[model samples]
Target: MTAHQNGNISAEVSDFLLNCFARSPGWQLWLSLPLSLFLLLAMGANTTLLITIWLEASLHEPMYYLLSIITLLDLVLCLTVIPKVLAIFWFDLRSISFFACFLQMYIMNCFYAMESCTFMIMAYDLYVAICHPLRYTSIITEQFVIKAVIFILARNVLPILPIPILSAQLHYCGRNAIENCICTNMSVSRLSSDDVTINRLYQFIGGWIMLGSDLILIFLSYTFILRAVLKLKAEGAVAKALSTCGSHFILLLFFSTILLVFVFTLVAKKKVSSDVTVLLNVLHHVIPAALNPIIYGVRTQEIKQGIQRLFMKGW
Candidate 1:
């Protein structure tokens, strides 16, 4: 046990060794290639989306502004987790400073919560557009988007801030080897000598309360939208409404599926390999980020035109 004291706190492990599929050393090369591709794809796609939105004045609206927020969140998540994982896989630089680990954990928790909130707000925007078309312009204004962004940050940061804080406060007097690629609350807290029942409970309960509520609200919004769309007697009205919400539905489905898969793998650890869980956890950070902008770009006509215009201008 290497004791390194920082300020008032004494720690046996000053840095954490990430055990990212270390048992199968040969697989690291194979894993590193795809991870690197994913990182590039995510960075490129999100950067393009942000630039396109910024350059195109016509695309400036509540929906696009909210999309920019989601894009930013995805960029943050990918940057927070993937680069370190790649370093671990490729260069075998697995040791992460104690402070860095906790910072990554905080970013993972807080930004994910913020993304969920942003999605819920986007759902509300859809609900307003579909269920009450007349009120949408008035309801989802520039001021409304600004307030929603404020709420998203405040709601997530305040609640999730305690998770890493609580985990970091624990005394780590034992092993510093984290079984996963990233510093998750459970993995980091479990390494501590202190009892982490509170940390686990708060992580579980707080996560559920935040995500669960968002899911429920999103569901309610879509339900109303579906009902309203079905009631439309005008020709192409149903198709138009469906088209309007389809991209968001697809993105939400992908996000929720990834989240569910991670949760399931975590719960079924006995049946699933630790390597698979870790891989899924790492992929969770990159895959959605890499795909979100693509999904939006393909689905939204304005974004496609904006991209075309951007290319033409550059050429």
Candidate 2:
């Protein structure tokens, strides 16, 4: 089935079938089991963390609030990609409407960018708290978070909104199978008969502008944080300070590393199987969602205590 754009000569496919993995269907059933477990863990862990933060008055600071936002974005990102993926894997429900595909593409782009921006903000939060101990409270206020959120939303959403729209305008000439689990902009655009150079170039430029800037800022913030931590004369104080920022740094490292691996896999596509690339892409979304909350709950003392309080009350 094809969709006709307004008086245009080119035809677009009305729906798409996701090329999930190897053509053999048996492996997918086994694959779905672990993916389902990850989704469940991601949802459960993030929800519990959100609730713990909500109930614990001490966890109501700007840092926790930013963490909560990250949890929310992670939840949304997982929900957007995983359910449909499970449906595709388990039930052979591979067909996705054109508009639905674009919507998924848009959400994935926007949320990933938002998550990157949030990490940058969190890095700044750590920097302020550690480097400017006296002014940390004044610098990382509720109003500052609100402004940062606004900036994040506007910065990411506005630039990414056009990507899916541009893809939708392309003539898809009956090539409707997406070679990945999620509706990535490039994956969808590649199906189009038109030259995807513009699409690829725009996304490349926009991604660097958004994620690149954030990564650079995050690196600088951590550099300052490390320098400040080293200046402390007391070993105990240095250890305590490092402990506070260590978890955030670790999660950030995981996020950046996986993403870099995915990019490298794409660049080295001739040597890597498409399955490996697709698997990496899928893991990129779910792994962080599953791990971020667990890391925070384990590392953040207040959150750990709040979780204990919650469990004790339940008991």
Candidate 3:
């Protein structure tokens, strides 16, 4: 019931978990303000996109519907991390409870998995539109689309449950600095007092499946897309095709780099000055969450015009 004498950490990971970070940069909330401002901007843009899709019957088609879902995912993606991250910085509440830390990690990963699935679906959607244009309607019907969404949602739910459960068993002896700003799996695993060989292995294994695999598939999808784009009969169609896939591809690259860096930085011994890696790791995460909506919203024309129209109508 009481905190471990040395702070309730496991005998094996006691030192590893303790004092890895100094209370965290949660106080950087002041610094996080600029990032928050960016998220706010995204929130507005994504909200408009959602509203426009719902209001316009023409936009109710599968493509727009999926776009709206992605927008919602993007919106939640930012909200889940940024607000809590900012709060930690703003209110000086950086120390997350073991329970709370596990929870944050779970929620964050849940959305991340969702992003992976969304990206996959987006790829398939493009595949159908480009590879088989004539059959697109029948192939990607409403029922089919709903099934895809459900499948992705299910995928997101399953892996995350084990993370928190396995983590709950770890005991923290004192070293709980939490290397990265948030309680990422890599950093948290390093703090284990118990035999973490399995944990480490699992981290590496999961990274390949969950993170690495997603990146590979995304690239493959784009390869097909680029091939299709080249064969397009008209310049305008090709341009439009590139425009659509380009944004998702760029974001995919962003995630692939940052996430791997985070994984490596965590697994690597701290013999070298890891501050740079840690910073990169945080930026990798924060930037993507902050930039997803902005990048997509700015790049997508309909979203841009819709935002202008939404507020303009109120005026």
TM values, all candidates: 0.95, 0.94, 0.82
Model 2 gets an lDDT of 0.86
lDDT tens per residue, model 2, 73-170? 99999999999989988777888888899999899889888989999999999999999999998899999999999998888888898888888888
Error of 3 at 190 (Å): 2.8
Residue 234 lDDT in candidate 2:
79
Worst 10 residues of 2 by lDDT: 3-12
For residues 53-79, what per-residue lDDT tens digits would candidate 3 score against the true structure? 777555567877776666776677667
Error of 3 at 304 (Å): 2.7
Error of model 1, residue 131, in angstroms: 1.2
lDDT measured at residue 5 in model 2 versus the true structure, 0 to 100:
27
Comparing 1 with 3 on TM-score, the higher-scoring candidate is 1
Question: Which lDDT values do the candidates have, in the order given?
Answer: 0.87, 0.86, 0.66
